[model samples]
Structure formats: structure tokens, C-alpha cells
Target: MIRRTTAAKGLALAAVLSLGLAACSSDGGEAGGGETTDTNGNEETSAEPLTIGTILPVTGTLAFLGPPEIAGVGLAVEHINEAGGVLGNEVSVEWGDSGDTTDYSVANSTATDLINKGVSAVIGAASSGVSLAVVDTFAEAGVMQISPANTATDLSGYGPFFARTAPPDTVQGAALGSLILDGGHCRVGFLVQNEAYGTGLRDNVQQAVEAGGCEVVYGGTGGGQEFAPGETNFGAQVTDLLAQEPDAISIIAFEETVAIVNELVAQGWDFNGTTYFCDGNLSNYGDDFDPGTLEGVQGTLPGAQADEAFREELNTWYTENEGGELADYSYAAESYDATILAALAAVRGGATDGQTIADNIRAVSGSEGGTEVSTFEEGVAALEAGEEIRYVGQSGIGPLNEDNDPSSAFIGIYTYGADNTYTYERQIEGSI
Candidate 1:
């Protein structure tokens, strides 16, 4: 679901079979919307408008993530406005680019700018590193910050004002471990980045594998690149992976995926026999590599694979409004849910400040005995009608536990195909 703006390997691609196979399948619950009015019965605004700002990457290494995430925000805004904007004030969005983690200044300045503008809540900074850089700023400013794609386990204890719709890497890693075992793979080796996201995930995956009486082939070998062009060589890392002689290798990286995959193939390693990837590099590789190079390759992404109908609808909307089709929808559902939760929190609290929304967020996302709703209009109406509302939207958000993370989630398992593209294979349902 992602594309990097880099050059491809020059080797002749394997002849593709069944190129563009059957459209991928997905999973998620659905609901309908109806008329809605604020609890105050006042459809008009008497207070300062509620402004939600986004720090998603519009021009960075993760810029490919921008379109779907940004579009998700836009769609939520449209839906919320149609349902009656939060607190009777028409909701509006302030846009800012989180140029990636290459520079903290860009993220810091942008976070400061959004805080200075008195944003009630913030939506992104897709990279966990980018979010970490500016999270404290948003927290100090008392603004609710939610990330759609950050999965680092370290972010679990972020302050009360911080939460994310996406589950942590711990959940994903453990699920992926179970997946490997279920697939008859026991000797899984991880060639992961040496950082919070990678280490956290690696630890979880190791724990799960070891718990299942399995062993990690190379449990501690760091495979991260220096994140620099020309210097971001993965030959040594690939050599290390081969040295471990792991039955399966799971790669965790960003733009460096191109080189790592190339190295694996160039060295005569079986490209699809035992290679795996995580969210950061689990993207459509139809252009980056040979046509059928990734056929039979597998990976895990953090959220549910959205259903085809919704995907088509989203792609259509994006083309009509945002200039192109949504190539990647990995975090789109989470982005939409995050925005909706923040707005619902504001509406429920009847205030527009961060702390108030923070206090009420969990309440609107009811944990027990609440009416299940999927849209803002339905949730708002349910709240007004004095019925407990539980919002299970596009991504199927589970209970936001006390740690501000999901108590349960659906980790999508995907498999690459003849065209170097992937389709959903199944889902691993997990919980605390």
C-alpha cells in the first residue's frame, strides 16, 4: 500500500504470473448514520471554534503515508460537519507537514505552531520517532495528541493527553510471532532496526516465540541502517542474516527496505521462501523489485485490512477531492477514528480544551454497556439520547485501556503475489 520515490533494482524482473490477481479482501464492521443534534439542542455556535490540526508527513520519507491519512482526516471533518460540528462550532482543520525525523526542528516548529494556534487536538506524525519528538510539546500545551501509525511499545506510558488509535508493536510483534509459528515456521530470525520501534517489536516477538517453545535464530543482531543514502548499505546486515542461517527473516526498516530486499535477492537467497517484513517496509513492491520477486513473501501490518467496498469508496472520494487514488490505506481508518474520538470527547465534555477532552475521551469511547455506533452522527445522537455509545469504526477500535492503548486489535496478515503486490491473507485477533 505504499510506494517509495527511489529507483528500482536494475535486474530483469521475474515473469509475473496472474499479475494483478484477485482484488485483496479486508475486515471491519459497518453501521449507518441518522439525524443528530447536540445535547444542548442548539445547532449554533457561541464559543470559539474547535480546530484540529495535523502534523502528518506531507513531504518526508513517510510522505507516501500522507495521502490516505490526510484524506482520512478530511473525511472525518466532512462527516463531523455534516453531523453538526463539535460543541456547536463548525470544525476546521489546520494543516502542517511533519517532514519526517530527518530534522527535529521541522517537527518541533510545526508542533509549536499548532499549539500556538490553540489547536484543541493534533492528529499525527506517522513515524514513531517524529511523534516522540513533538509529543511532549503537545502534552505540555495540554493538547490531545493521537497518532494513527506509531506502534512503538515505549509510547505506551505517554501522558494522559496522548493516545493513539493504532495498537503498539508489542501487540503486532506477538501476533506476528504466533503467525510464524502457525505457518509452520519455528526458527524466525529478525533483522530489525536498532531503535525503539524495532527493539520493542523484536522483544515482543521473541517473547511470544520463546513462550511457544520456539527459538529466535539471531535474537540480538541489529540490522538497522545509518539512514543515509550511499552510506545506508545493508550488505553487512544481509551477510549477518545469512550467517545466522535463520529459517525465516523479518525485516524492520523504512526507505532502506529497497537495498535490503535487493541484497537478499542478489545473494541468491530465496526471496519468497523465508523473507518477511513489518509495517514500515510492508508495502506494494510492484515497481521497486522484479515482478514476481515477492510472490509468497509475507508481512504484518498494524490495523485491519479495510473491506473492498469501503476501499473503493475511499479511492473514489480521494480521486474526486484529493487529486489521486489512495495508494496506501494502512492507517487511514485509524486516522479517521482518532479524529472522530477527539471530536466526540469534545462534544461529550462540552468544552474545547485539551484536558477536558482528555478527561472525556474514554467516556465517549465507552468501555462497558454502551450502544455500539460507527459514525460521529450516530455516536453524537446516542450521547444526546442518553444512551451509552461505543464507537467501533472502520478499524474496529477496541477498548482504549488505561495505558491509552487498545486492549485488543486485529493485526492484518498479508502475502505478496505474482505482481509484487500483496493481498490480505488473514487476521490475528489478540488482546491483553
Candidate 2:
């Protein structure tokens, strides 16, 4: 009985998908669908399944999100195949684990393998650092790369081939700062990992916090304290931030968040209550921490709360197929949407080639003038009828903004309950 709501509906910013049978593209035949030429003068494409590669964290700090994120792409594939597949064929996935940013070895190798395999797109690299590590590879190869959970503002200029369903941390950071000030916290301190994700978000939060007429006791001007990628010792970082005696604190870390939160408690700080978490560490620390330790803690993440029925369905699918409940739902909806949007763009552009998908991708995600559809089947049907579509996915994400990001999307404010986990408190909508 988890509580859920698409609360962004009341506050959504601008945003704006398609489907159909074999359609015409500049290419005589789409590589993913109908017929393609072989050097052997044969029209047979390889019997190997055409795949979408996923680079989710499976062995790293973000592994807690692996199950749900993996399941998300799985379910999207399920839905695509049911709609007669993308381009007259069933869709498949190439899965790879992104072992966080401390070492790019795993992500680099996995990305290379997926790229070499000719996947039309790569669907992850959830951490901003992880994504940046090889985003240039995809861009150089002209491949479409979509992220389900990347929010660092720096990624805005990563390139056209890179798109994300998750709004940038600029948006989430601002909202978080505004939320803090609105709550009357006049002095704030931030503890962040020293990485693209942490630093970028911290900078944005600092901007918003300062703009809201508050003082930032830590970070940049207050002497920003940064931790290494895999650094687990938080006692020093905690001491650094608390030395400022700030009224509120912000913790930006991955698995390391657990250690830091616990340490703050040991130091008798209202670390959980007056503290805030961004997407990087906004997860179910419920089972790992003592009951109610993280209760009343607040955080913000892109996208509105997903519909409960869809949540149940995704969980049911995972339970039956992968066993056990979907552990975390943080970026699951965005992951599903990223895969589906890529697939639909392929269909609409009438090819499974990366370049084609890239060119027509924005057509399915902008602010206005398209038929609105939710599921793959519905989008396909509309395209068959020769109608354009704008898909708002499970998380209530809107159309892509001018910069090829979810310009208009929701930033859900979440609060940990007595279970030491979180539920959506509300969704704020605006463009960043």
C-alpha cells in the first residue's frame, strides 16, 4: 500500500511521441524494419536481435537502483514488442553495469562493447560523471544516448545526441533551495561529493539559496568540501560542515550518504530533519538505517510521482520475472520513458539507425502541436493514422525543451516517513 501521485499535473511546465506501421523515411528501407542491403547482394539483415544498450549501475554505489532501472527498460521492451515491435521486429537490450565514477573502466568497456555491437542507442550512465565519461564517444559516433537519471546542469551542452528524461539538477537544485528558504532555514551548509553530479548540483543549490535571501555557510564561498569518488569516511566532512554551525545542511553523495547521515546523527545534528538530498542519494535508506532515523528528511528529484497502478504493474512484472519487489523507483519511470522515446523516435523516423533517431527525436518530445499519447501501442496507432504525437510518460514528464532536455517537467519534493524511506510530498512544475 504505497502512496503515489502524479502531483505535477497541477504544476507542470511545457513539454510535448508517435507510432505506426512501416513508414517512409529518406532511406528506401529502414535498417531496423523492412529490408537492408548486404555486401553479399543479399537483403537479409543479420539474424542477431537489434538491441538498445543499457548502462545502469549494477555493482557500484548506485546498484540499489539497478533492479528497478533494469526492469524499466525491460518493461518498455515488452511494450514495444507487443506493439508489433519497432520497425517490424522485436526490440532487445544489451545490458551493462556502470560501476560508478571512481573508475571508468567498467563503463568505458561496456560502452565500447555496446557501441561495437551496433545498438541504435545507449540508454544510461545514470550518474552524471558516468555519463560524461563516455558521452563524447557516443557523440563522436553520432549515436543517440539517453539518460534516465542524469541531472547535472553541465550536461546541457553535452551534444544533441545526448538527451535525458530527467530534468537537469539546475531545476531540481533551484527548487530545493527555494524549498529550504520557504521552510525558513536562513543558514544552510552543503556536503557534496567532489564530482560532476555533486559539484554541479551544489553550485545550483548555492545560487538558488543565495537568491532566496539566505546565507550558504558551506560550499564555494564557504570553502566547499569535496570527497573523492569512493571515499567513505564522512567524519571529517561532517566536522567540516558542522564547524559552520549552519541551520540546515544538504548531503550530496551516493552510497556514501548512509555513512554521512549516520555520522551526522552521532554528532547530534538534525542532519536528517533539516537536511536535504538530491537525486544522487535520494533512495530507500530505509532497510539500511535504523527505523525512523531518516524520517522527516526531505529531498527532490525530477519527475512527478508515478501513477500507483503503473508502479504496481512494474513491481508485479519484476516480481514474476526477476523475483522480489522493485527495490527503488527513483529513475525507473524516466528509464522506461527514455527507452520508449528512443524506440518511438526510431519508428517515427522509420529507421533503427542512430542518426535517424537523433534527427527525429525532438519531434516526439517538444511543447506543442502533436497528438498526446502515453503507451507505445497508443503512440504507434496514432502514427499509423499519420498523426504526430507527444508522449508524456509514466512519470508525467512533458515535452523536451529547446535544449533537448525535459524543459518542462516536474520536480517532486519527497519526505522520508517513519519507515526511514520517502514518499512524494508534492510536485513543483516550471522551466529552468
Candidate 3:
């Protein structure tokens, strides 16, 4: 069975009955409930309200991703509340900043504050390295940590309390590797970040590319050629990589991509379909480069492209609530799905605690056969009708597997135009 435990359902019923009795007798309108075990095996009240905290990149290297991700979470919260919330109480969210890996202080302190605030789950730290820094803190506190955009392979099965809506690097890596090979590039060079996310993804891409009869001429995994996170200057790295005279080069870093691109251009490297990008470094370079600077370059990002209706909704919601327009939609769908899945798990397990969510998330994600649902309200209605519901949300990810990663997902391929902005070319589906 996908559900790890059967005890939560009975406990949830008991808590509901207890609350009912308390509501009938109490003058202050406070409800009573039974205690349950958290992920850390500590006793906690089952009647606690569900409060999710976000540790997303509000500042630092990945700041460009903040707007859409935050909007996705906010929209999910709005939809959940409109559906009468989980366990008969409205869901609440706390926001915090998860700066990039360059400064662990931001993520650590944010994780500390969110945990101290009694958040049942945390949905953030988009960068895998940032998550690696704070995941243990949340895990030890019995708080579920679900990332919307973490793809490092090492994070799979990191802990029972750790889950992510994003598929692992295995899926994206294979897609990107196949794309590069299909371009007829047999010699590839990498400019990977020397961190968990970068190295892990680089390894997967290397394997896929090599399997397709290609050679990594430079900067493959463990070649001691990766640049440090937050590296400002890449002249040396770019020069060394280009010295190999490879037919193709892949840049696997975050904000440092701008510097790398500048160095590549300065060294007379062509971006005309020869350069590839992964999710981390793929962004609108219109502001950073002149027209046609990145023309024909291609990149891959995980998650299905948001449809026009969803994009408009996200834009409207963000503009109204956040006073900003949604720019990048990279992990927005994944973020929305992550939030909804966590909420449904809470409902299914009948508790607003992390352990219960961990126990039931997979089942709600359709690891076991169930009625398909697309919205929070539909899912709630199905669960209320005594049916197990499989939530197929905006991201279009497959069911959560035993490793807590999506079993299958879509990888979006994009190509840059003359304006240095990327357009979705197509999607490749992969199973992990």
C-alpha cells in the first residue's frame, strides 16, 4: 500500500469526534483533540491547524524564480481556503527567505524561524544545495519539507519527511543529454557548479550522453573543473573549457550564468545552437545581453508548460496579491502541485501534522489507484465521499514513488530567440 500507516485514519476520526464534543460544551469555542506522534516520535495534538511555511528564494542568486514560485503557493492557499480548507479549518502559510547556497545563514535562520513557528510543512529552498543545508533541521523537528524545484539525485529518499514535486535529475538529465546528442554533438564540455545540484545533474547527463556514444571533452563529473557557487568571474573556466574546442557546451549553474555567458562571448564562442542550458541557468537574458546574443541556444526545464488559462490566472493572482507580474513560469506549476498534494495528504490522514502528511502524501498522489481529481475542492469532495483521490494538478507529474520523487514527469525544451528570450519548443516525457 502507498500509505505507510493505517493508524492516522482512526486517530483523525477520534480527533474529529473529540472536537465535536468540545464544540458542543465549550463556552470559549475552543476545540479539543487527541494527541498523535510526529515524525520525530514526539506527542503532538492532532487538532493543530495546518500552517505551511515557504523557504523560497526571496533574495539571492535565484531571486528571478521567486515571483512565480511565491505566486503558485499563494494561489494554492487561496484555492484550498475557498474549498473550505482541510480538516474543517482554513490553511495558513508563513513566508521566509532561502537565499542561495552562497549564504547558508539565510536558509538556516529561516528554517529555524519557520520550525519554531510550528509550521507543519515547509515548501521551499528551491536550490538543492540550499535544501541540503536546512533539510536536516526541518526533518529533526518533525516537519515535512517538500521542495517544488529540487532535482539533485541525492535528495531522493533523503528522509521519510522529505518530499518534492519536481522529478529528480535522472529525468531532466536524460532529456537534456538526448537533446544534445540529437543535435549531432559528440564532444561536449560542461561548466557545472561544484555543488550537490550541479555535480549530481552533471553525472546523470554525462552518463546519458556517454551512453549515446559521446565523449565529455572537459568538465565532466569529478574532473576538478567545476566552478564554485557564487563565482563572479569565469574567464579562466571559460578559457579552459573552450580550449577543448568541443562541438557543444552545457552551462549548469544558477545566477553565475550571466558571467559565464559574458566570458563565453568575449572568448568568441558561438551561441548559435551549440550552447545548452539546464534548469538552473536557463532564464531570460534579454536584459543582460544585446539582441541575438543568445540566439539559437537551447535549454531544458522540468515541468509541463503552464497552459494559457493557468498562466493568466497566475499572472492575475500575482498582480493582485503580490503587486508584480509573473515573469518566469519554470517551477510555478510544480509549486502549486506541491502545496495541493501536501494539503490533500493532511486531509487524507486527518491531521495537520508533518508525520501524517508524510504517511499519506504518496497515496493522495495516486501511488494506489483512485479517482482522479484536478482541484482541491474536487479532491476534498471525493475524500469526503469515502473515496481515495488522485490529485492531478497543474504540474502534470506522475504519482510519487517509494523514493518520494515523481515517478514520471515532463521536461520542457526551450530555444532562445533573437531577443535573448526563450520560447517553449516542445516537451519530452521521461520515467524515473
Every model's TM-score: 0.86, 0.87, 0.90
Query: Candidate 2 or 3, higher lDDT?
Result: 3
Each candidate's lDDT (Cα)? 0.74, 0.76, 0.84
Best by TM-score: 3
Predicted structure 1, TM vs. truth: 0.86
lDDT of 1 by residue, 102-150 (tens): 6668688779888887788999978888888889889889999988888
Winning candidate number (lDDT): 3
lDDT of 2 by residue, 1-432 (tens): 111112223211321001000100111112434553322233444332346887887667777777677778878887787777875777766666676888799789878877886777888978989999989988887778999988888888567799998888778888988988877798898878888898888888889988887888876534756778787778877887789889888888898888887788888886456888888888876677778788778998888788788788788867765546876687889989999998877766666777767776777764545889989888877766677889878867778776778867789899998788888889999686
Off by over 4 Å in 1: 1-46, 219-231
Please give the RMSD to the true structure for each candidate, in Å. 8.2, 10.0, 10.3
- Model 3: which residue pairs collide? none
Runs in model 3 lying further than 4 Å from the true structure? 1-46
lDDT of 1 at 406: 76
After superposing candidate 2 on the true structure, give the runs of residues whose Cα lies further than 4 Å from its correct spot. Answer: 1-33, 36-49
- Give the clash count for each candidate: 0, 10, 0
Total backbone clashes of model 3? 0
